[model samples]
Target: MDEYFERRKRMVERLKDELKISEKVAKAMLEVPRHLFVPPHMRREAYNDYPLPIGYGQTISAPHMVAIMCDLLDLKEGERVLEVGTGSGYHAAVVSRIVGEEGLVVTVERIPELAETAKKIYESLCYDNIKVVVGDGSVGYEELAPYDKIYVTASAPKIPVKLLAQLKNGGRMVIPVGDFVQHLYVVDKDEYGRVKKRSWGAVRFVPLIGEEGFED
Candidate 1:
């Protein structure tokens, strides 16, 4: 356990430097046990800086990418965050820790089996603030409307307008958009219904499949 923590600490340090995130976010990365969210077979590679396959045709986002996106979202304690594509539940777990009990993290996974497994992991880890739903994530979770922050893990051909509607005033959303190649898009909505969009860089992710996402 000591070695595992040490490795994660080092990884977090590297992430802080590489991703240019605050120390608080770096600490969150270190504190969240990535190994617990991964499969036992992949536990040894948990601290690696790259994404790892987590069954169900999904892969956990790389640490650097996660740090970059989280930092870009500018998450704060007690903020309501919506996460599209829970994948292995690693990202949601990280957000759960950062947001703490006062905050709420609603994560949507399109696959039932993956949602079930991730729910078990969240329960075992005692992340009571996170709510996992098994359904099409592109439409956004309506019951938990008006999120302070939104993150779309899967790449889509374009930003989901429905998701934009769910963002509170002055809220931000990070999404990867494209087909063969993707770019990280940061979108911000203001009180007057004006939106600002920016591109971080190129990235590749599994296609976000559903209404408001890819056609196929």
Candidate 2:
């Protein structure tokens, strides 16, 4: 337990230095036990800064990526957020805490097994505000439309129109685009339905497979 706390503390410090995120966000990162989100066999490396495979050909994103994406989301208390991939539920859990209970988070995952595992972890962590759905995440969850923020964990060949349509005017979305070399993009939707895009940096992520993504 002491070692876990120490490693978590280091992760917080790294997030502060590397990502330049606020201490409040760092506090949330420190408080959340990432080990609980990974498979038992891989728990030892939970605090490491690298992504780890979590079955289903998916990976729990690196802590730096998580922080960067969350920072990009620019979440506010009581804001409704949508997450494209739940993975191990770590990112969704972080978002859940940042948005608070009054806020809502709907996370979609294509794989049923991963979604089910993430749901169990979210429940165990008492993250009641996060809702997990097993489906094609690239299409976005329209039932909970007008989300204040949207985050896609997987890489897409192009921005999904469905996801852009789901964002509330003035809302922001962080997504990675490309196959071999992915770039993190910030997409903002204006009230007039105009969309603006900006690139943050380079990243590599698993391909997003769905209606708006890869054919196979």
Candidate 3:
């Protein structure tokens, strides 16, 4: 655990130097034990910048990607956040720390196995602020509609209106949009419910598959 903690500090340093991530995001990234979310065999590489496979043909988003998304969303303490893809639960775990105890992180996972594993990992870490839900994440989780912020870890054919509708007024969302060629987008919803978006840069992510996303 001490070794992983040191690795996290180094990782955060790189993120700050490379991406200019905020202190809040950096602290959250450093605090979450990424090694716990990954499979036991892959724990050694947990603090590395790249993504690692977590079974079920899905990969955890790279540490850099997670840091960038969290920065884009501008997550604040006591805010409600929605994560479209739970994956290894590492991303959600980082988010949980930023949001703090008053805030909530509802993460949706398409694969039942992955969702179950994520839930177990959250329990082990005593992360009560995050809830792991098993469902099609493309459509967004309406039960907790109107999130203060939202982020999708996968690439979609286009921005899902369902997800946009779930973003609270004056909220932000960051997602990867496109098929063969994906680009990261930062979407903002104003107080009047108007939405504006701009491309951040190109990125590669597993396809978001469901009703409002790619055809599975």
Best by TM-score: 3
Poorest stretch of ten by lDDT in candidate 3 = 1-10
Overall local distance difference test of candidate 3: 0.93
Question: Candidate 1 lDDT, tens digit per residue, 37-143?
Answer: 78899888999989998887889888888888888898999999999999989898888888889999999999898889889988987889999998889999999
TM-score of 2: 0.96
- The ten-residue window of minimal lDDT in model 2 covers 18-27
Tens-place lDDT per residue, model 2, 1-216, is 688888889888987987798765787788888998889998889999999999989999999889888888888899999999888899988888889899999999999999999898888878899999999999999998989999999999999999998999989999999998889999988888789999998999989999998865
What's the best-to-worst order under lDDT?
3, 2, 1
State the C-alpha lDDT per candidate.
Answer: 0.90, 0.91, 0.93
Error of 3 at 88 (Å): 0.3
Candidate 2 deviates by what RMSD? 1.1
TM-score, structure 1 vs. true: 0.96
Clashes of 2: 0
TM-score each candidate: 0.96, 0.96, 0.97
* Candidate 1, superposed: residue stretches over 4 Å from native: none
Q: Which stretches of candidate 3 lie over 4 Å from their true place?
A: none
Error (Å) of candidate 3 at residue 114 is 0.5
Candidate 3 — number of clashing residue pairs? 0
